[model samples]
Target chain A: MDNPNLEDLLIACRQGSDDAFRKLFEQYHMRVMSTAYRMCGNIQEAEDVTQDVFLKAFKEIKKFREAASLFTWLYRITINLCIDKERKRQRRQKYHENVDVDSERITIEEANSNENTRTLDQQMWQDEIQSILQKALSRIKPKFRTVLVLKDIEGLSYEEAAQAVGCSQGTISSRLNRGRKELKTLLVKMGMGEEYFQER
Target chain B: MKHGFTQKNLSAYLDAELSPDKVQKIELHLQSCESCLRELQEIRSGKAVATCFENPDWQDTEALWQNIQRLNISTPEKGDVKNLEMKRTNLWQRLIHPRPAFAIAVLLILFGINLFSNLKQKKFQYQRVQLDQELSYGFDYGLYLDALVAGSPAIEFERRYESQQASYEQARSQTTFRLASFTHMPKTFQLREVRLLKNACCRSVQFSCLENSREVIIFQQPQGHPVTFGNYPLERIELNGQMYHRIKTGKWTVLSLQLKESQFMAIGEMNESDIAAIIFAITTI
Candidate 1:
């Protein structure tokens, strides 16, 4: 949609119009849900975070200044919520450390069985690669992980990433560098061959 | 060229975040640097791996929106759009143009300090008035005597005796020291009232005499008791082998003398000679 049209839609949403809100959700829900999924490493949590983001955006639509684009604002909220969810997950992991080991082993076995049943195809291979990437991404710290997700995965420019992260462009550049190095090291350590990353 | 490029520079160059000149310099350095090129390739591979993780299609957009709408229904609305827009504009203006906001914050802080100091001063004044009232009613004898001799309004006595003999008897009964009485009286001055006074500092008997419109008071207390009253300078004089300390305050004269076991003070608007004569005529008998 054009800028003026988006502005009008935002105004309508601010006026407590449910139709405008639904239109906004239709327009950006994919991107929001996708980013949430990458950040959370799970579809369920991504859906939950996406719902929370839209609800918060709807409620705070009035406070939305025109200084930033709507997408940037939504992304900022998504990143914050994702980080909060990550922290809670970490706390839960610590609480159920012993219980989590068995569950994690079962999940890995199930994933192997599912993969064995799938026909060897490009789509399945891509999905497997995506899953492995997500696991590595989740292993990295949230600060660097967010930068990588925004810059590499989501393809946001450094300026846009800086705005979404509420930081300077220099900080974004620095974090992106570290995040790339850490992700590369983690992928190599995960025994993913260098050929997997070779351009198809 | 020797160091090629730092990881940060290479990363920023890959993202096209660096300035054109820096990007040109790094590009030139990369041509001659094999290790940096290898590192750059590794970073590219990482980026490629990350980019391969495309956004999984979310099929539950409608369900999620419904859930969001349901949640939004329960949450209270902040305000109408127009009011919120105005507030947002004001907030943005404050952020974008901070000088006015800073000036207003300073003014508010100054106003708060002024208000606090005024309240503190008022509280201090109130406490001082309360303390003065308590001291007066508590019969601070020194302050009362000072006020009387200075011709200011003295604190009221707790009890007044109808007759001089009755007051003298009460004074003698209440005190351990020998009480002195007037043997001879001045013809012009007639006794008016007598009061017994006591406080934390000391206890004394007060005799009030009236000479027409003017008044005189005599106080008798135990010798060596502490006095907490005026800051007046004293003059000493010997009359009939009795040493008297005299102080003049405003129009009133105070004459004090130590007898055998008691201290007697006469306060009145009288000449020095008359007060001295009154003191000499008083005896323990």
Candidate 2:
């Protein structure tokens, strides 16, 4: 949504209009949900991040500066939550690895459960390729993955993505290059073959 | 174009984030250098591959909207109410869980203040007794009257009398009074008892009558008792060549008469007409 209408909605929301809030939720929930899914790699976590972002946005709407677009603010919140969730998961995993003797079995069981969820036919080329890409994407560092997801996957312009990620356009450019190279190397390692990256 | 452009520029060129001039320079370089062209193709393909992470289906949107609604509803508006709530909560928290040193200091300060006030009140009680004796016309009656009224000694006396009514009753029964002095009281006012003031020299007789449950007190001070009724706006009325002083203090109007040995002061909530009648009746005795 355009800033003027969004600014109007924000003003109305600040003036305590439930209708304006509902309109804002309707307008941004999809994009916020999509960006969260791209960043977190799961529908459930993405929904949680989406809800958190909008709830945060609603609570802090009075603090929202007109200089920044509403989506950029929402994107920043969603990104932070995703990063926090990822860090907490990593910490828990590290702790479990240290204390839990059956950590290896637990990891295998988690993998099996994840595999079980993707019961989509492997014969479908798009689903199979996309599933492999999702796994490779999750394997990359979050800093690079975020830049790549915002720029390449979510299709935000470099300037918009920079604003969303709280970085300069030049940094977005550099990170996109590093992220693309890492993803390409990961895909090749996963037997997608070099030819998969050669075509435009 | 000098080194076939860097990978950062190549990525920017693919993203169309670079300036048009930079884009043209990179495109021309890509055309001249087959390796640069192949690398651009690789970056483009990789970018496309990354786009394969499709957005999952949105779920629980109603629940999320409800949550957002709840958040908005629960948020206090930007006003004094929100600040007041935060301040109230902070005050409540501090009050309940005060720091040990702070709580101790507060308790000590409060105890000191209470102790100091109690000591001052005890001093005032003693001073009040001195001021009451000085209320009789002797030296600087205005200053002593102002001090008495300002300190409100009457309220203190009332408080003491209420607390020690039985003690006052015992003192009243033990006290002796002249039977002829009893004639100074009016017929409507029944003489309850004669009680001694704290100063053993001063005595007061209490009288009660069923005139709207009113009671009168007559202070009968001994002869030449250094006490005078001179401070009040007294009207000198010579009844049958003997002088009487009529005065009003707050709700009670007093009729005072000086005899050869003692001063008699009668005080009651009696009206002007009733006061004249009582004065006339008391003086005739």
The CA lDDT of each predicted structure is 0.67, 0.62
Residues A92-164, model 1: lDDT tens digits: 7763322333444444445455655455565765676676677778777889988898888777888888888
Which structure among the candidates has the greatest lDDT? 1
Which lDDT tens digits does candidate 2 get at residues A1-200? 45557767888877768898889889888888887887777888787677677766766787776734777777788888889888988887752322322443344344345554435543344455666677677777889999888888777888888888999888888788778877886676555644456544
Per-model TM values vs. the true structure: 0.53, 0.49
Q: Can you list the residue pairs that collide in candidate 2?
A: B223-B261
**Residue-by-residue lDDT tens digits, candidate 2, B1-285:** 665355557789887777888888877776778877776666777786775566655657898788656644554642222332354366767566757668888999999998997666432110001123423433332332322323343443344445435333443455343222232334455333333233232233222221332444444454455344445676887765778776666655566777766666565556655555555544543
- Candidate 1 stretches with Cα past 4 Å from truth are A1-4, A95-125, B1-5, B31-35, B78-285
**Model 1, backbone clash pairs (residues 3+ apart or across chains), number:** 0
